[model samples]
Target: MVAARITVNGKETPISPAAPHTTVLDFLRERGLTGTKEGCAEGECGACSILVARPGVNKPTDWVAVNACLVPVAALDGQEVVTSEGLATAGEPGKPSTLHPVQEEMAVRGGSQCGYCTPGFVCSMAAEYYRPDRCAHADADGHTDAEHGPNGFDLHALSGNLCRCTGYRPIRDAAFAVGTPTEEDPLARRREQAPPAPAATEYTQDDSAFVRKSTLEETLRLLRERPDAVVVAGS
Candidate 1:
């Protein structure tokens, strides 16, 4: 068995003796964060899209959408993850204090139905909203991260969420409709666009080149040889 640590929402937890093949959806659902839903289970469908923020080697931080159902639980070690459950600000459960601007705008714009897909869309939008510099690029993609990137908006950011009820037009509208942060709520503004940390840490190892080890001894030897290396010894 292997041990791993990760921050869920904003808290850190350890996954020791974790099964080698556990998917992220299984881990979150098992841990009681059911806000993250699953529809197609494959990466093609954005139903399981969740924003994963991991310490980066080159960039400020790497946050992207991932198909939780297909993603292995072991991949989440030492990262900051935010789910639909993390949408609300720091307050009463489900309170709207720091309600992600996307969620707030979505609520006013009638972007949700049945509510199952709301969380996924919330998570995706939160990632887009949180990154200040992303708006310019997201804007170029036709979905710009700008508070007012597009009026009708594009399905590029939310392509991961599949909503059969709203037909996506209203949802897109709501996403683009989110206005600039106002002084009415300072917390809301903080959540929408957070400043980056002054210091950058080497929070993750490049798993793209890592090959699985067949035995514990081999894994130990590998780690000893390359102390800074990221090795996926086992599940």
Candidate 2:
């Protein structure tokens, strides 16, 4: 079997060949990161959603919402990826030992009922907030969508995350109430940001290689060829 190196969360992990058809979800779970769920192994559901970072900076990296289940395992090599386990530490710099503003907001506003989909939504929101090129433009809010932009505090972040228990009202309020917490958590001031819009999905300066595969055989063939591939699999 071929081998490869991958940077998950903030650590480097070495992976093995999967006979060509392993999903990123399986890889992550096997590696002990159960945060990347696998409700629907297909691209239709965002359960297996995780963050994959291609090197980029002030010029944000191109962040594409990809299906981990659909993406072959050999496509990820030398890539910087973030899973739910790493979001608290790797999210938008400046905050340490704290949950990402998005996730924290969801908790505060009662946005998390089942909490199964919270991680996916948080990562997705972080991508939206950090993508430099994906500007929301000056809507009713004076400036473009700031991390604390006016429209930035909306329930749409929950769209990627599913909620079967609590209705969307609390989730919406949570997304809208971020970074503006009450006396309960005073430090929230520095953490809050605005809601992200559509164009805000793709980050600038981000580089990622997208490899499409239909079956495990093709994926294994690719892995055998590119031992250093970065594969994101399903659980």
Candidate 3:
């Protein structure tokens, strides 16, 4: 059986055929990319969050934060995924990589405590930091008033994430402190030139299979043929 190849953190990773049911969280951990943690496998905790690039109407690509534990490894084929480890700018071999704005802000503002939920929070916050409408709510002074600015940072973006030790105030502070990102930021460049979404593809190994349908017809056909198959949806 051929290994299922997928891109992770700018490199192509070949997944073994024996684990068709592997979750994205497991896939990353297996490769030692432990930055993405799993606090709850049910997708309620948001502790396994990671950024994913998907097709968009207004833009070439849209960045979204999703629970890695809830996503299947096969579903990642031909898709671009960025884990917490991939958020920072790559540095020279002997130098340390520069931290992403979200990471820097989180650290400067004391957003982490036990650190179990820090990785997930950082990924989710990074998604919001890169959002095109992030500054929509800023006032004339270029600052968003705490819980008052209309169109400002959406605190609800962190609704899916849970941080039992740090509480919400510090995290909220980090979110507001993210300020404007510089042009040199990798994510800033990605926002301007994200690649288009990949076409649907099917992955099969032994008796197990995973299918990503690009069109309604193909999706309907799959549902009709496999009525009892489990379906997962992402928002």
Candidate 4:
């Protein structure tokens, strides 16, 4: 009875009006979230990175960075997403919002240039920042390497993001400079709780339908009924 929806930056939005094939990037952009760029429609460019909460190995939820251009809006029914604009904490009326640790480091360290890829880089870096094992692994190793920072930041976390004008030194500096999340950090505290459970959705508009069954048995039954249905994994 209820329409399919997604929670973006803590706001619940209905996923209708947009077509079933609309990418997450387009959906967000249509709502004035211009930070998610589309450098390449293909997933090769990391210009459309966004944070997604998913099951984690060490913590209850992990802030996972994913390419928005590659995922359909319909596939994220009942999911929660955080764009670059959502990273900052809102200030009191008329006051400027406080930046997240990753954004602060990036600004102070000159990590942005032209500002196209900066948001994507920030999202990816934030994902690594919230990684539960990052600090523990660094402490265990007790030594920094070319690919890992002294603070346990693995440079590989940013391998997908690319910059054309700004050199990587500043970006690397920013990534290495971010400190651990404080106890008061809401995003950090979210790790203690479970990520949102997947929702079974059946959304239709303009004669096109998108469905997500609650169980494998129902899915298999639907597949048998509709032989033309295409399966999409991890959409």
Candidate 5:
């Protein structure tokens, strides 16, 4: 079984005796973090969207949205993950927590209906909100133009998330309503202080092994060592 420690929502979680193929959705739900739902398990629905930050690389900011149902828990070793539950800022004693700007816009704009898909949408939108290219456009009123294509907000970001009960109008409104993030935003601070990307690591569970090589030389060496191993690419 794969055993490793990973950071979740800024806290370290020790995964002991976990199956190598255990999905991230299953692992999170088993820990009572049900905010990330399992919709199509095949990774097409985007209902299990979550933000993942690795040790290295910084193209689309530090974190990127991913489908939890299609990701193996072992793949998150030494990485950081943020679910819908982590979107809100912590509240003071006896005070209510403050929702992220994306969550607040979604609620105020009636973007959520049945709430089953809200979490996934929130996570995906949060990633887009933190994108570096998000500040390219904004009206003087500080709102994105929904009528225009490729404005400050990209509606295509939500293409993966599906909502059966609600229309896309309100959701699009919420997307446009998210103004340019201020320096006070938690994610903005994270982006400002993100660490460099991490090198690839290998993990093993029973007879199964998962390896992520940092360099082509290392990958070739491993392949030469295990010539009989099955090689599969892309989740």
Candidate 6:
């Protein structure tokens, strides 16, 4: 059988050699994508946030932020993930990469928390930045409030993340200051296309195994065949 693979930061990588029980956090960090941190393994801190392309309501695909600490790497067998590092655009050979709008605003407004939390905050903010409906409505006066910003940024997009050293005032300033994505922004353009369909995967290592059927009927058939199977949704 072909090996299960994952697309991370525009690169296709094999998911093998990793234990079936490895969390996406460990999987990513093992490959030196260390921006995803593990503050609370239980998914409370949002420090391990990463973006995944998923079916969308307003557009074909939505950049959804998910917790990496809880999900198994095998769960994302054929999905694409965008880490904090993936948000930057590569510049000329020696030049610094261009920062994503969220990262740019956070840096300019002093919203960066400690090294551990900054990437997570940036990723979650980026998801909101690309929301198709984020700027669709305009209040007559562009009034800013506690929960909503003049730029149409919703504070709830970041509610999952936690920070101790950096209070939210500066972070809110960053979120409120970002502008709509330009016509040339790649991630913004990505919203126009459909997200990748789930791949049929069967991965096993040691005594552990993971399986992803391509259709509902196939899944049901498998359930009948193995009543002891555990089911997980959304990978």
| Candidate 3 residue runs with Cα over 4 Å from true position | 1-3, 136-151, 222-228, 233-235
Would you list the C-alpha lDDT of every candidate in the order shown? 0.62, 0.56, 0.79, 0.91, 0.80, 0.90
Q: Per model, state how many residue pairs clash.
A: 5, 37, 1, 0, 4, 0
* Per-residue lDDT over 1-80 for candidate 2, one digit per residue giving the tens place of the 0 to 100 score: 12355677667776453434456778788878887777767665576777765434443343434457666554564455
lDDT of 1 by residue, 1-235 (tens): 3336667776887754446456788788889999888777776656666777644333445455667888666556555566777756677777646666788888888888887777787777665554434432344456544334554333466766778676576677777766544456432343443323322112223333333354668768877887887544222
What TM-score quantifies how close candidate 5 is to the native fold?
0.84
When sorted by TM-score, best at the front, the candidate numbers are 4, 6, 3, 5, 1, 2
Q: Stretches of candidate 6 above 4 Å error?
A: 136-138
TM-score winner: 4
lDDT score at residue 210, model 6, on the 0-100 scale = 87
Task: Give the per-residue lDDT of model 5 (tens digit) for 200-228.
Answer: 75777687877778788988999999998
lDDT of 3: 0.79
Question: In candidate 4, which residue ranges exceed 4 Å CA deviation?
Answer: 136-143
**Candidate 5 residue 80 C-alpha distance from true site, Å:** 1.4
* lDDT digits (tens) for residues 24-135 of candidate 3: 9999988899988878798998889998886544556667888999878887776778998998888999999988888998998899988989999998887777777665
Ranking by lDDT: 4, 6, 5, 3, 1, 2
- On a 0 to 100 scale, what is the lDDT of residue 84 in model 6? 99
- Pairwise TM-score winner, candidates 1 and 5: 5
Among residues 3 or more apart in sequence or in different chains, the pairs in candidate 3 whose N, CA or C atoms overlap within 3 Å are: 137-151
What tens digits encode model 6's per-residue C-alpha lDDT throughout 73-166? 9988888899999999999998999998899999998997565788999999999999999863346675566888878899999999998786
Model 6 CA lDDT for position 35: 95
lDDT of 5: 0.80
Task: Indicate which candidate wins on lDDT.
Answer: 4
Quick one: RMSD of model 3? 3.0
Name the candidate, 2 or 5, with the larger TM-score value.
5
* TM-score (C-alpha, index-matched) for candidate 3: 0.85
TM-score versus the correct structure, for each prediction: 0.66, 0.61, 0.85, 0.95, 0.84, 0.93
